[model samples]
Target: MTTDDKLVYMANQIARNFEALGHDHAVAATEDHMLSFWDPRMKARILALAVERADALGPVAAAALERLRAGVVPRPQTGATRFAAVDESGASDAG
Candidate 1:
């Protein structure tokens, strides 16, 4: 898919996953809660991570975004855990 298409697709996937996890409100509140501490490049990375790590809310947003861009579908959130796994190399496995 085109880069924009991929970004929008990933965003939709993240929104779906968040809703599935009972955090629909948080997803809705994203525009309000989003911070602006990073530069343009870092901000893009954070947006990308938001899609990959739909379960987590922390400094790892950039990593999650990169993973999604690489075609990885993060592990579904379950139990008491809220974050998906980061690979050994700090990247995410696409499987």
Candidate 2:
């Protein structure tokens, strides 16, 4: 399949996976997933496809793409940012 086609399929799959979360949440999740996992080139390509041929994408995916195109990106937390140096009990494991 063409790269654009693959991107559409992938976006749809991501949308499907997050659909159980409900509309708003699913769109956010799909957007976050793409932002965190897809490279800049992939994102740009998808954005172009979103404008040129959005009907190929699922509803949630299309919404997410529109959001991305509009610069409503969610900041993805990296491993270091997601994990705290202190434990949940307020104790540090470092020596």
Candidate 3:
């Protein structure tokens, strides 16, 4: 399968895994999983595909992608953002 096809399959799989949770919950879980695990470039591509070929995505996957594209939810924090930086003098850079 093509790259986009693979992405669609993967997204659909993730959505399907959460399908038992109910609609809203499935959407949230799918979005969370993507945000947590997918690279930014992957998300960008998926977002583009979502706009151009939305019909390919499952219902929950589509809703989750929409939420991501709309920026209505918080992004997952990475290790870099999770801690304060310490300077040479040992002072924390955080606020």
TM-score of every candidate: 0.30, 0.77, 0.76
Model 2 misplaced stretches (Cα beyond 4 Å): 75-95
Backbone clash pairs for candidate 3 read none
- Per-residue lDDT, model 2, residue 28, is 86
lDDT of 1 by residue, 1-95 (tens): 66645544544454454554345343432222222122466446556546654455432333344443455543333323233456344333343
Q: Which stretches of candidate 1 lie over 4 Å from their true place?
A: 21-95
RMSD of 1: 12.7
Go through the candidates in order and give the C-alpha RMSD of each one to the true structure: 12.7, 5.5, 6.1
In model 3, which runs have C-alpha deviations exceeding 4 angstroms?
Answer: 74-95
Clashes of 3: 0
Instruction: Report the C-alpha displacement of residue 54, candidate 3, in angstroms.
Output: 0.9
lDDT leader: 3
lDDT of 2 at 68: 84
Best by TM-score: 2
Report the C-alpha displacement of residue 19, candidate 1, in angstroms.
Answer: 0.8
The TM-score obtained by model 2 is 0.77
The 10-residue segment with the lowest total lDDT in model 2: 77-86
Colliding pairs, model 2: none
Ranking according to TM-score, highest score first = 2, 3, 1
| Cα lDDT of model 2 by residue, 1-95, tens digit | 99889988999999999899899888988999888889999999999998788778889999999888888976552223333454454343443
